[model samples]
Target: MRGFLASSIGVTCAAALALPLTLPSSGARAVTPATQSPAQRSAESVPGSTQSLPLISFGSDRSQGGGASREQGLHQREVKPFSLVGVIWDNPDDELNGSVQVRTRASGTGTWTAWQPVETHNHEHAADPDAEERASGRIRGSTAPLWVGDSDGVEIRVRGEAAEQRSDPALHRGEAAQHSGDAVEHRASAGSPAAAGQALPAGLRLELVDPGAEPPPQGSRPKGAPEALTAETAAASAVNADLAPLGADAIPPLSKKKTESDLIAARGGPEEAAGKARPYVGPRPRIITRKGWGANEKLREKKFAYTRTVKAAFVHHSASGNNYRCSQAGSVLRSIYRYHVKSSGWRDFGYNFAVDKCGNIYEGRAGGVAKPVLGAHTLGFNTNSTGIAVLGSFGYSNPPAAAVNAIARLTAWKLGLYGANPRGSTYLRSGGGNLYTKGKNVRLHVISGHRDGFATECPGIRLYKKLGKARSTSARLQGR
Candidate 1:
């Protein structure tokens, strides 16, 4: 166990130097195929990519009842082929008191789909107001991204509520406080009386994501052929080496007895190492590593931040909608990752892990999957908790049984690592949110829904209703 820790630490140090702060230009940038043999080239699949475009006002708004009720959007236009779409604005603290809708033309059919509403209440799925990440001044307000399948043309509309009028500063505390220059410029340009009623925040842009291509599956290389490793990929994969070989697609599950033995070894106390005390850890479940999903390692910040311990698990729905196939889960993940970092200004993917509709689990965010990695999810409750996002909107759609079962298996293993009971309750001091104020000690379920910690509707009603099953199953797996 000690040797495992030693090697992990060594590799982490060696790879840390290659961590990046900036993102690559808008496209997948994997190692050039020309530099590798045919086998290596085949192993390197096409990378995922994202394109960001700014949104412009539609036309004169006087024709739409009240003159103040204006709309911002793009008329029917062709763009690079993309499968997902969302909108973002400057100032993470601002609220979009409005409706956002989009319609897309199918990639090859030339037929356009009916306009769909994008989830607008997305502020609650973010870093707490006081975290260093929020203070970094890069965060942006975003609408939940929607999957549109493969599309080549699109149209969108964003119409703000016409009832209220307030100064731009009052619209966003963070922008007024930290980015006053940008705010002042916005206010000055939209100074007309009509614009004051429902003016949108500045720097609003549309994000079109092409979740590039899936990575080649494991064992695709010729027998005994060596695997290629970029420094970024190595850094992302090294943290999980304790559970799987470097660059492995997934961590193989362990038997209950093996899990207990490994848990004892990891604790490293003489008494615990002797296996005199029974550990309440569950058998590890298979988890797809970041490499398996074709994550652009260069798209995130270098260093990882962690809390002291994980006391709770917060579950969420991607809210990107349910228009994707299980085979495209990796592509969806890569798109979300790019959207989080490149489009929304987050340091990395917000959740600790993600589960596809088919129940396949994929690693989210960098850092060791076993560690207490701090995530920009479940605002006011990120500390001492891990976040898991089920990949789809579940508000109107019933969650798949396989997906719910996968959540149980995941929390059983991960929560057990910190001695947390999946069915029990715990207290987490709020870092500040709509439901709880800063420093408030709140009692919550160990396995809670995203809405339990924030005021937004997330993890949706259908998925949230199944928490009872997840908790019971998780406890049973832990042999409680």
Candidate 2:
């Protein structure tokens, strides 16, 4: 399957060799290609770009009892093509106590789809309160990005909930009834006043992301004196050289025996490997490296962060929606990577690994895949845990069986390296979050959902439910 994917990608790249490639630049909305001036295409195609449109206050002003009015968003309008969308604000610390919904028109068809809900509880998927990344002035409060496919037109609404209602557990979990199409239509036709609630965070902007075309598959012909790779890129790729050739597109899979042998060798001889007893570890699964995914390594901080050990693995959904093709997984990852580092101001991609719908696993962040690289995922629990985000929204949609199995395979191998039992439990000290106070040691499953560590609907409801299957399968793979 991995070979097949690589071959397919090669063919695709061959066909698109003529397309201009560039590094990411910053910007927002422009005319569509069909009507775009040459200058517009040239600007939009500069690697990739984000169009940030400020969401304005709309609907009747109903401020009451000193509460701020609600319904802050932009009406439907045309713009440049974008495959992903999210809402971002000025402050990383301030919470957006509201619901966010957006409906978009397909770029070519001009057909608008039903309004999709954007996960509003994104604070829990960030760096610890005291982490340097969190302290950075550029970090912004952002909603989980929603993958809306290729869209040229958009309409969005952000409705804030009252302060008292904000305390409700249901609302925090995003379980309030969904905004239906008919209701939106009725509200638009009747001109009904939006419900008044708390004020949203300042500087709210709708971010439209075009992940840009996938980079030419690794090892293709040189494109005009190949751009010099940055020292940061070289350092990031160096960490994975043990598992793959430097600059290789992927680390090929190995059998259980080979993996065990490599594990023993890595422990500085067989004497310290599993205390003389044969290590019970799963086969090494194929992993696409960061370079394979076209990560602009220069965007991340030069220094890599590390933890003492990986005591647990946190599973999460990108919450970037499911409107993507397996072939485009690289693009989706690039967009999220850019969003994390460039837009949200994270030090790097938050998750350590990402699994696509087709069961392919991609190495995330810059640190070596084997290292206990600290991630800005699962909020307070990131100290000793690695995060693996499955691409797409899974709140209501069923996760693909392949993706779930990929999770099992990934966790089995990754956790087994640290001698963690996939089905067992471990203690993780909280760095502080809504769920656990600072300095508290909480016992949690070795393989836990994002919600298990924080008060957010991450890894989504449907995906969270499948963690059981992942755990058992992982244990079986580890020979436990």
Candidate 3:
């Protein structure tokens, strides 16, 4: 899984170029290959072919206290048509008291290349004193030349285990097989234990295996002596005997029919259930509003003008401290607006709304549902989407629960007002042109930080992964 970090405006633009864009499916339309320009073709090809590039592995020793630990055991794989580029890793849990370093060498060469020190940190575990306690941190460092020739292969070596208590015992792994245009074959594995030794040669055979267990028999298990399993057989027999008292179908089947009690629980109360079960309860307006001049004034003052209302939402973070208050959130929004308008030369704040560490929603770039407006948060997507900026950076600290909840509530409100459905819409950006060009009656939709049509780590990697769940929650709340 790729993680996104909150970055400054300059870094955001640069990183955006490095990250892939996600598009909404309602607006997704396939463009013919013949219509693609050379640049587009190259951009599409790079991500697919770059995986085989040599990967450098670094070792970190975290046993030492206070002072920085030494890094050693740098290794690189030797393979045809490949060269070591660079290596990047993180001690997010700094509990390891470790250091990381990388070295590279040409394929088939005995002489090892000089080691390059990428990054080292000593205070990564400051929050916790127990060496066994799990900590949180990240390493974003990467090496150059992340690609090899057409037939190149790369190796990655990882040193130092995570703190025992924090280690992820489950080894989730996957493999892929590909056939080149010229009929050449290739194989790749991620997180697989066999990946280190079993090299596929000119053929496609993808396999998934458990890293913690012995590899499955390539053919079949060999015959073994019955005596070798006598104890195990006895244990199984005893367990069976113990379970014999329980009749067959010991577990009751799940009930499909809803009882009166179930209906009451589902509806919150009999009154609510009756209202929903029988309609014609006076005139129910489609829109709901809080009656207050102060609220209305706040809403109007926060509104701004844009070329057009966007079809999607661009998510981002301020990359600051987590100790944010509602009042301070307003100042952060002002600073972000000034930075984008005065420095980046944009029209007002780039985002439409800002969510604070306390999860308070503040008016941003101004426009709202009454008069949809587009902001410059997304280069090509501004015309069809809304931008929501979360206060504080996510690079070092995780988002607060309040902030996440506020985002969900705000998203639900926007989607309901726009009459968009969360289902039947894919959140991937690809092809040419905007995705909303084909959909009808598609008022509002939600997408990830990367999906707003630009790159960069706006929402951060951890938050990006939860986008689907967030959208679903918002939809359910809106009764969509």
Which lDDT value does model 2 have at 395? 81
TM-score of 3: 0.36
lDDT of 2 by residue, 100-183 (tens): 999999988979999889888676788998887788787998988888888899999998776656553333455222211111
lDDT of 1 by residue, 310-428 (tens): 89999999999988999989888988888898888898899999999999988997876777778888988999899999999998899999899999999998888788999898888
Which tens-of-lDDT digit does each residue in 1-480 have in candidate 3?
001111111121211122211111121232322333453233111001112222222322334333222322323444444222223222222122222333444445455544433222212101112111111122221211121112222323333323332222111101010111111121111222111211111111111111111112222335641111122112211111211111111111111122222223323556745645421111111111111000111111122333322245656664333444564444334333433332222334456666777666654543222224444444334444566767655644667777676666666555333344443242322212122221212222354453233223445555555566766766555555
Question: CA lDDT, every prediction?
Answer: 0.76, 0.75, 0.33
Off by over 4 Å in 1: 1-46, 59-69, 163-197
Which candidate order results from sorting by lDDT in descending order?
1, 2, 3
Q: Quote the positional error of residue 233 for candidate 2 in Å.
A: 2.6
Per-residue lDDT of 173 in model 2: 50
**How much is 415 displaced in model 2, in angstroms?**
0.7
By TM-score, is 1 or 3 better? 1
Candidate with best lDDT: 1
Write down the TM-score of every candidate: 0.84, 0.82, 0.36
TM-score of 2: 0.82
Candidate 2 regions exceeding 4 Å error are 1-46, 59-67, 164-167, 170-197, 222-228, 269-275
